[model samples]
Target: MVQDAASGDVVAAGTSGEKKPGFFARIVIFFRQVIAELRKVVTPTRSELLKFTAVVLGFVVVMMALVYGLDYLFSWVTTVVFGVPA
Candidate 1:
């Protein structure tokens, strides 16, 4: 038996009693489910979107700075160990 998550209702009794849907019916069902799920999505408000974008950009900038510092540190370490390349 399959239980519906959203409504907390039993959707199917048992697989033994029911015949499987045909290929086209299955396709239709899949599209219907996709549409249903899409309907549940919440769109961010303009302010919320801007805030999220700013946060993401800030995070990326911080990550880039960290990587750049690491690369610079490694380069310096290699230079010190190997002596300056000719």
Candidate 2:
């Protein structure tokens, strides 16, 4: 048997005499910890958020242009190989 350093409560190491926390008790404990953690979250300001959104939109637009260029190049090559219709 070991005593908790701060609380001085006796804690058993193994399953011999320990009572398990119930399911609902575990869920409540989990939510309490989540709320405590969320309280520490820092949200981005409006300017920072706008900058991130712009960067993402720019990247998507560049990717779309690249894909369209590749598609057009392939279509032109296929027409040349198979011969274009008169």
Candidate 3:
């Protein structure tokens, strides 16, 4: 029984007691919503993009180093456990 504030009607959660629209109609509605949302996007500045890229790269490098260290540690442990000549 949740009512929309502006329309004062019970908004169906993707399903009301109504028949679904046809396939073409649904597609048109989806693209209309997409265009509407795309209009609201604000592009980041060049400096902001550069800073975000640098942070992402730094995080990836740190994760790579961590995984490499763990891999090396496990290899050493296996060698010692089985006494394999390495």
Report how far off residue 9 is in candidate 3 (Å): 4.9
Tell me the spans in candidate 1 whose CA falls farther than 4 Å from its real position: 1-14
Better of 2 and 3 by lDDT: 2
lDDT of each: 0.88, 0.87, 0.86
Ranking by lDDT: 1, 2, 3
Report the number of clashing residue pairs per model: 0, 0, 0
How well does model 2 score by local distance difference test?
0.87
- Ten residues in sequence with the least summed lDDT for candidate 1: 11-20
Expressed as tens digits, the lDDT of each residue in 12-81 for candidate 2 is 7443455667899879978998999999999999999999999999999999999999999999999999
- List model 1 lDDT by residue over 1-86, tens digit each: 55556688877645346666789998998899999999999999999999999999999999999999999999999999998968
> Which tens-of-lDDT digit does each residue in 1-86 have in candidate 3?
33466777987744455566789988998899899999999999999999999999999999999999999999999988899765
In model 1, which residue pairs have backbone atoms overlapping below 3 Å?
Answer: none
TM-score of each: 0.81, 0.66, 0.77
Q: What does the lDDT read for residue 29 in candidate 3?
A: 84
Candidate with the greatest TM-score versus the true structure? 1
